[model samples]
Target chain A: MTQRDHQQKKMQIRDGFIAGSPIVMGYLPIALAYGVLAQQSGMSLMELTGMSLLVFAGAAQFMGANMIAFSASAIEIIVATFVLNFRHFVMSLSFVNQLKRIALPWKFSLTLGLTDETFSVSSIYRKQANQAYGQYFYGTLILVAYLSWVFGSLLGGLLGDVIPPQLSQSMGVALYAMFIGLLIPSVKKQHKIILISVTAMIVNYLLQPMIGEGWGIVAGTLVGGVAGIFVLDEEENT
Target chain B: MIWMIIIGMAVVTLIPRIIPAFIVDFVDFPNWVNKWLEAIPYAALGALIFPGIITVVPEQPLIGIVAGIVAIMCAWFRLHIMVVVLSAIATVFVLTL
Candidate 1:
């Protein structure tokens, strides 16, 4: 590559890292908990880390660990996780406009790392910038978030048993905090967001006892999303 | 047997994330689809956070709620995400002390 192109690439990568820092921070404690939980549930270090490496979704990983703890069959675990991660299809399709200029191979590889945290952070960045999402920018964000997850799992696998009970348990709140942070600015910008989100939360809560784990979220997402479309914001309309 | 579970989880998770992006490149989504897509993040994050947040710390559910309120405040003020996260963690730590 030419000198200027190389310099641009470096800058984009740096931006990606900066954009991803909060997500990395957020992922660290949760992934650590996941690792610890997996280890306590009888997974080896390799199995724990391998799951982190290959199946990077936080919610699904937790579900898998819980099911494994109960000795759920492999097919049952897989099917449950697939249903849990079905929201990724919505996330991916939402990102299509920003991802248009990216090459096919890079786009495909980058999608592999499309966790909830990365999607929210990168979407905010893409909205603010005049340009399309650069390959290096997207790739670096994914790489850093992915590594933090893997390493956090590894640490948990190694140290899960040793950590004080209270401290590790406190880390459970971090992921929810991060998700709250991600949603606040948007909700502020568009008042309609508050309605959609609150409705979804209520629906999820109401459905949880009846429908069980993952499906509640699915039902909530569909109801809230459909409800949101009809409640158009005045700002976007003009 | 463990290997089977790991591979199975990997394939199922990857398919939802990867397949849609590939298809979207080829086909155009209708306007209603676009509108629903826009709301996906808000709806998904909402569904994921609530009720679950209350239960995150089963022993002291109040601490989780307090931390979540702290997070909402920080984000509302447009503080850095790291700051929001750190402060929430600190809230939980302090309450438990």
Candidate 2:
């Protein structure tokens, strides 16, 4: 690569790190909670960290840990995880389409790091970025977030007892708060987002008791996406 | 047994995430399909927050609700995401104390 291209690449990676900092902040406490919970549930430190390394998903890992604590069967845990993570299908599709210029190999590796937080950050960033950002931006973004999650889980597993229960428990609000932060900006720019988001929230709330939280999220998102089709203007998409 | 479940969960989870990258190259989507995919993130973000937020502090659901509202207010003011999150965490910590 030329000197200018290399410099640009470095800048992209740095920007990615900057973009990833908030995710690092958001993922740490939750990952820590997962680590503590998993350890308490009889998972060895290796097993819990291994789950973080391999799965790299927050909600599903927590759910998996809970099912394990209850001695739920392997098949049951797997099915529950699939149900919980089904939202990723749409996310991956949108993410891949968003970065269609990036190579297939990069897309595959990037998708491995895709989570609710990273997807939201990247989707929003792509729209607002004035210049063309490349895969290195996303690669760095995902890497930092991934490392924080794994490291935070390890730390929480080792120091779970050291931290006070109330403090650790309070960290649960961090992820939701981050979501609100992500949603509010877009809602300000485009009023349609309010309707889509509120509709999804209401549907998930109503359906949660019946079909369960996993299915509730899936159904709510689908309903909300359809709501967008009718409500969102074609011009706003650009 | 734990290993079995961990591996199983990993496989099932990865399938949904990785499959799209491979297949999306082959099939072209319609305009509406693209629209639906574009809308997924907003909708998913909403679904993730609600119910999950209220239930974050199961014993005191009000803590989560109050924290969530604090987050919304902070975010509305265009504060940094880190600030928004920490404010909510601090709110919860104070409320629980």
Candidate 3:
């Protein structure tokens, strides 16, 4: 509100924007893959764009589109997506604390950009910054991600099955690589992360062939995360 | 139906992020919950990443897995983003040739 406060806010936005640039390296290819997948799924340009506008999360959107291509019922598609994406809720809990003092409407916009990549990037920036422009910094990052995803989907939609199947399939590697990059920074902290990683792999592998593909994500998250806590508690107490 | 999808996306996305706000109001969690919480992202990212790595590749199933390794290593080294990307792309490129 004050002149000094406003200036500081502007500076935070600028640095957040600069720091956030690397995230685009991750977003662009993933978005491009989303685009390619959407096309392969037979989504019309409008439907793909509509998804980009509404759903926005790349993996969930891909899942939803793939389900639609298979003639999945609307309920099935929506539920599957919700299950796949529920981890964002966990990401947001701590995320919202900083904006606890900001107004409701701005918080709403910040939530839009709270996709996994955005959450990781912005949260790191927020820790370095004072509260002055937490909202602004997040806003810029989300805006860039949102635009990249939508546009990439649009390009994929337009390209439409032209991409070779091998290339199409290989695109899945981009996001997996991003995940590994994210993990390197925190991998050393505790046995808990190591245990959790092992648990997630086991749960996913065990559950996928038995329970189902889409369902494993929801199950793996809860089972793996909870299992890690129990194991940690026992180890720490003993 | 469209509105439902839009609203569904909005609510689902909103709920996960907001759970801790009202969540603590009703339920109490133990201290270990903090350690569990720290690994949540890795848990989530692993779910996504595992499928990419383990899914069998076609022409050379080995190439497919190798591509995943190369890309992640390139990315890990903080190699130029374009190079990291091209590493995977080139892996597929050579194999396809």
Which candidate has the top score in DockQ?
2
For each prediction, how big is the interface RMSD? Answer: 1.7, 1.2, 3.7
TM-score, predicted candidate 2 vs. hidden true structure: 0.95
Query: How do the residues A41-128 of candidate 3 rate in per-residue lDDT, one tens digit apiece?
Result: 7776887788888777877887877876787777877777777777677666545544455566676667656777776655444453
Ranked by DockQ from best down, the candidates are 2, 1, 3
TM-score of chain B of each: 0.88, 0.94, 0.58
- Listed in order, the DockQ scores are 0.71, 0.79, 0.40
TM-score of chain A of 2: 0.93
The lDDT-based order of candidates, best leading, equals: 2, 1, 3
In the predicted model 2, the residue pairs found to clash are none
Query: How close is chain A of candidate 3 to the true chain A, as a TM-score?
Result: 0.75
* Native interface contacts kept by each candidate, as a fraction: 0.74, 0.80, 0.37
- The fraction of reference A/B contacts recovered in model 3 reads 0.37
Q: Per-residue lDDT for A43 in model 3?
A: 72
The candidate that achieves the highest lDDT relative to the unseen native structure: 2
Give the alpha carbon lDDT tens digit for every residue of B3-95 in model 3: 466467656756665555554434545667754664455566666556546553544567766777787687567675456656776776666
Write candidate 2's Cα lDDT for B1-97 as tens digits: 8988888888888888888899878888888887887787788899999989987779888889999999999999999989999999999999988
Winner by lDDT between candidate 3 and candidate 1: 1
For model 1, what is the error of residue A200's alpha carbon versus the real structure, in angstroms, after optimal superposition? Answer: 1.8
